[model samples]
Target: MAKVQFNDVSFSYGDKKIIQNLSLEVNDGEIMGVIGPSGCGKTTLIRLLCGFIKPETGSIFIGETCVFDAKKRINIPPERRNIGVVFQDYAVWPHLTVLENVKYPLKKKRMDKKQMQEIAMNALKQVQMETYANHLPSQLSGGQQQRVAIARALVSSKELIVLDEPITNLDLKLRQEMLKEIREIQKTIGTTIVYISHDQEASLELCDRLAIMDQQGNIRQLGNDYDIVMKPKDRYIFEFVGISNFVDVVAKEDGVYINAQNGLVKLDDKSVLENPTKAYQLAFRPMDAVFDNESPIKGKVVTETFLGNITNYFIQLGDKQIRLQQSALDVMKYGKAKEGQEVGLKFVRKFYYEKEEA
Candidate 1:
């Protein structure tokens, strides 16, 4: 029920800077996802928000409480922050039963045994684990253990719930089920959840808003799923979200001049043409590109993988490889493409990225 805010936060380990001056806000009852590659500052940010690591030069606010303030030299302890954290490894005590694990957090309060048991059972049922209340952690499966962990967090009724790669260890089927379950639980209880993961696709699908962080701990982009996937702002982001084919071309007054094509390809967004002298990288999604029989652009299919509904083709044109994902039905209409087959490719939608200065 609380909004989390980080204002100009910066954190470092010894002399190595992990998180730079970053500011982000998660609205009350919102599920915000934090995604990045390995070694990025995703976990560090969680630690800072939980009050385990204090920012060197900023303030963090959880609802009305100023949990951390560098200038004022104030740092609130984790227990007082009223935040629940579900670690990547479901941190359940092997000796404790499902009910005991959920009731452990409530033991800190002076609630009677009967009341605690009722609350704990309710939390377990929330996660559909009430039937296994007497089962120890060692007897339960990984997914069951995860359910116990979530129930433990829910029993506290904290303001913010941070799930660090909660479904990473689960199988594909179990992951999907857990994803839906987590969303349902959050919506049912109206608790603000922050999902942290390295998988861009899962984060994009699960979160209302996303924050993409880089290896250097910089926030590369922040937006909804469509914006981040379709129109990436940077080269790093373009390659991270999905497969994209890049073509090098020079910008002109009228359009982008493709040296290989020896013709101008008109772009919808003319902003990249501002720097007429420099070359820009034009990117388009594989699914957006279509194979045309008459188009001059040609490539040899180096590899093709059948994935039931869609077939992914890796075509080599000169030295560059362009990936195209064609629907199985479309392939049937056109004709199943084989390796070493010469195909004409044309992009229906494209985006441009400015060349980075060396």
Candidate 2:
């Protein structure tokens, strides 16, 4: 296993900077998930780490070895970096059988034929593809192909593995299964892994820690799944990661007060507000609020969607449209609320941030 570190790493393509003095670390054997919107430099970071592209500045280290150091002009080739990568497309050769594909990476190791075959078989067994050793890529399913690709990556002495949207091509069931398998294999082998994806749900499920990158090519937040979800650092991170309702508020010594057109709500945490009389943004998740008949904050329901276990309502109050999600059981208990019905909203919890001035 290896620990990867990036110190002031920066990269750019032509005139556009993709990564701006980014610095982070992934500990040995830890699975770190890198998540961001498209064009947020997640893929570029992967490329820079794997030696596919050299960074314009800074250094990258794997364990004690300096793989890429701009100051020293040290640039190690991808094969010598002792890292394995699984791409979104699987990237297995159609002409090679499963066993051959797995053994291909080991061909340069000067091992005997039997030793190479044994190592390849063991790798395939780790991915549960040993029985299909002779099958060609054309004959295997997408999931099966992905397994072979993983087996190929693990067949060598790689200390770190980079998975770039590895499960994106699979169905929902297969994706979930693959996630379990990946986690299990990583634990068993104790290989440090970097998982990059645009899917937040998958990242939340599979990562030991998450690194959220913003559109400005910088790390926005780095923490556990719950910390990132429940306590985002700012408005941009909160809105990018999950659903939130924003209301304008006035700051005060005792609390931050929300002055909605139809009602008022006060936040108990005085520290959230920097000063009195300044406008703040009150952000809360859909699950944090409820519909109260007597609430002073009112809205007209524009649409109601029944999403299996939960129901979502898009309500319009003044110039803003707010979303609220409630359990189906709650809807049943309260009776289904109809569209066009004006309903009151009560805040159960909220997050406070200083409003960005336009």
Candidate 3:
């Protein structure tokens, strides 16, 4: 496996700069995901790394080879970069059979049938689509077709594989299954993978590390799932990761505190308050807002959803609404909650941030 590094890379169409001064590395044998909102340059970053687009400034290195370096006038073509890319479209040949599609890249290397078939079949069996090897891509379902595309991308002995929203079009169940398969395959192949997606849930679950970008082409935060979730670099990342419990916290000389709606007192660690607030948005996951039947921080049970394993509570707290995630067993113990039933709430966890400046 080879490490892929971007050093202060920047690119744009004409005058519109899509990526600027961006630099990051995908370590060998690790899966790193690039996640952001639509039009936040996720795809552009991938293209740049794949050598589809050259950086207008700085360099991109695959292992020690400088694929793109403006200063040195070094630029390598995509086909010569030794990186396999599976784009959003699957990019499979409609007229080609599954096995043929997988064999396409190997043919460029002049590999024989036995050699090519062995690689293709192994890839197909990994995706559980080996039986459909002789069928064309059009004859397979979307998920199966994608598996073929994945197999084709892997047919070559490349050190890095970059996938752009590999499971975007699949249904929920298949999406979940594909994520597992992709992560497993990356491990089995021992190839570094850079996956790009806008889905935070998917990115968090599948990636070893992740980079969250913003509209201005800034790489906002880059780290493992836990670090990003527990200590987000900013409000954009905090909210994007789906931990939406923002309380109006004020830092005083003593401790950080928030008087949530209905007199719910939220106290932060004194250590966080010792320094002036670095962030304006004090956030926490909805799951952290623990509920009890015997506390003073009271709120009405506005709604509840039974989701088999986990029952979600939609509580109305003064002027603000908050969500609580609890087990179905807890819901069974509490009985069916009536709308407007006064319930006790307390802040069990919190993350503080300084206010955003417009």
Candidate 4:
């Protein structure tokens, strides 16, 4: 419906800077997720987009309208921005019925009572909460209350919506169902959405593209889930996206070698390292490594954990402990390794990164 753009936006709270020279664009009719740990300014971005706070520099655009521009001195109020917001707590009025809550936005425009009722009922139907229009939020379940809040937001602004950790309080099953429902609604109406959350897995499941932020409030990477997970741009991205293992590695005349408990074990694939002369560490995901008896790379199994879908193995390589995962099917095919067992490791895929300073 509408594309959102932030051009060289920067914000600060007194002496502490939150965002700096951040530029990003969200395409029309797509779900763009902004994910990062707490204190990374995810909420600040939402506030800036909603016109609740002014940026120290740069401009922001929604579709063709310049909502906020520091140089141009153009500032649009939040009420006039026509951006809907859904919060994590399901910000529904407990006193009002579902229909009344949805109609509250239309009341500000002084639309006729009948016309407002019709629009509100239509929005309720869109979220599949039509039958409970007369029910109060207190009478509804957590999921149902969320649906009411979503309907209210839709009734207010159909073009652009911001969902800030909307389903974080819900149970696991309810969270999944809510995500599915949101996707269905988006597909049907083609509303551009900005979903902000710290949950990486949920963001991956719901978003079309993800923007990952670091502690300094800078976007480290922005791409699809596969690229962010498999082809991370830096060590921070790799460690933040999923479970990762980093082992100290040294380059030798023969090949690259991983520092092991017994001695240095030569890596099977020397081509993984782009620059063998520079200091680098071997980095790989838990699912990327496999136990091989013939491989020279070895580790002692410190512990083994049986998760429902996958088996987790904690292997001690020298003094550092790393994790490896095997699916249930894999365990059925190849027997599980015992604790304290010396196992040979072969990496199916690996990356080399310079060690970060402490």
Which prediction has the highest lDDT against the true structure? 4
| Per-residue lDDT of candidate 3, residues 1-358 (tens digit) | 7898999999998999899999998898999999888888988888888778788899999888889999999989888888777788656898889888888888878878898789889978987889998998878878777777777777665588888875356777777787898888887888888888767988899999999999988899999999898888877888888958765665666656555556635453554543564544457786677666665667778888878887677877656677887765556554456667788765666766666675
User: What TM-score should be assigned to candidate 1?
Assistant: 0.90
lDDT of 4 by residue, 219-317 (tens): 999998988877899989988888889999988777788987678878877465677767888899998988888888889999999989999999999
Better of 1 and 4 by TM-score: 4
lDDT of 4: 0.89
Candidate rank order under lDDT: 4, 2, 1, 3
lDDT of 3: 0.79
- Candidate 2 wrongly placed segments (more than 4 Å): 166-168, 250-272, 275-279, 328-336, 340-342, 354-358
What is candidate 1's CA lDDT for residue 275?
A: 66
Give the winner by lDDT: 1 or 4.
4
Off by over 4 Å in 3: 166-168, 250-281, 293-295, 329-337, 355-358
**Can you write out model 1's per-residue Cα lDDT over 1-358, one digit (the tens) per residue?**
9999999999999999999999999999988999888889898999999988888989999999999999998899988888878877656888999999999989988899999999999989988999999999999878788888888888776578888875455776776677788899888988999889766777788889899998999889999998898778788998889776887766766666543332443433445565666668778788887777766666778999999889998887655677889897668656667898887666777877776665
Worst ten in a row by lDDT for model 3: 266-275
State candidate 2's TM-score.
0.88
Supply the global lDDT for candidate 1. Answer: 0.82
